[model samples]
Target: MVATTLRSIKSLVPLLDRVLVQRVKAEAKTASGLFLPESSVKELNEARVLAVGPGGLDKDGKRLPMGVSQGDRVLIPQYGGAPVKVGEEEFTLFRDSEILAKINE
Candidate 1:
């Protein structure tokens, strides 16, 4: 059976066409060929730009500029965010200001 998904309402603070995201994968295995379980892995300090919201207001009461685009992976704090669940995956949302840096590779 297929599962249905829910989309979030337009953000109140305005994403300016940007959505902050935290990945669900907590642990990665080492090169020893041994697999590490979720409980054994250390959480990484990273995130990604998941979705883009509506455009921001322009100087004349219209939308302004957007700081990020889709598929852009970024880094964020370990704490300070709201929990969200999309289908079986869980993620967090942070304001653009909360983003520390962007990852190109």
Candidate 2:
């Protein structure tokens, strides 16, 4: 089902919204408890924003405000985001509110 839905790497984030996130890498195993893969073990909550959607609606039927821009590194919830595939890349499409923080460095 998801295999056919995903199309491209580019997202359609709007002015007041953002897309959900899915870590690119999977989990890892080692002697020291469990290790997270490099791709998944991003710097804090920072992640390479894969795809984005249009902004959300506002009270007056207007658009709300957005924070980060596409391609920007951001921080999202640790347990949310639905898994999906875009082109050859896998991603998660979670709401911006679920995001914990955004990284500038």
Candidate 3:
């Protein structure tokens, strides 16, 4: 038999009813090929779901299903998400109930 190595890795796992997401970056250039200045570029309230927590518990101790899942695109509020950073990338965590809406496209 071949030797198998088991390693413990650290990763971000959101708690109950929480969802991890990365903001969708805004375009730096306009349709007419003009580059917008940093001050003029506005941050969007949109993000992509990276991970989701196992749903919250109900009054009877039953687990409720999460509305969003990994790889989903959603709308977030202008404020109130907890910021997180992994390596050189930045992410945010929001409660499932706080996610504004899912983007169909």
Candidate 4:
């Protein structure tokens, strides 16, 4: 997995109600300290928010507040979201509404 930093993706920003995030890599080893084979490692549906777009407009033409902000850990769906690449790092773009939940941890 590529290492991502705020400086590397500083130029890219989501437009409206879109969020940019980097997927959290799944652990290759189990709690027992045994290294698992590539096929056994399942991809996690968790990600770190890198950037967020300005809130979308409401029915009254006023801007609504975004649910999540940068640096927030969130739960995403298994599928969907547009894939984005910055330098060697890979990221995903999802609509704010598409984020399943915000992780407290």
Instruction: Please report the candidate that would top lDDT against the real structure.
Output: 4
| lDDT by residue (tens digit), candidate 3, 1-105 | 112132311266789999989999999999999999998888999999989999999999888999999999999999988887655566788999999999998
Give a tens-digit lDDT track for model 1, residues 1-105: 122365542232335644557564654677886788778897777776676566656678786555666667877777786666656666666666666778888
Task: By lDDT, rank the candidates, best first.
Answer: 4, 3, 1, 2
Per residue, candidate 2 scores C-alpha lDDT tens digits across 57-98 of 878877665555567777776676666666776666767677
Worst 10 residues of 2 by lDDT: 6-15
The best-first sequence of candidates by TM-score reads 3, 4, 1, 2
Candidate 3, residue 18: how far the Cα is off, in Å = 0.5
Output the lDDT of residue 84, model 1. 69
The models' CA-based lDDT, in order, is 0.63, 0.60, 0.85, 0.89
Task: Judge candidate 2 at residue 35 and give its lDDT.
Answer: 74
TM-score of each: 0.66, 0.61, 0.83, 0.83
Give the range of the ten consecutive residues with the poorest summed lDDT in model 1. 1-10
lDDT of 4 at 60: 91
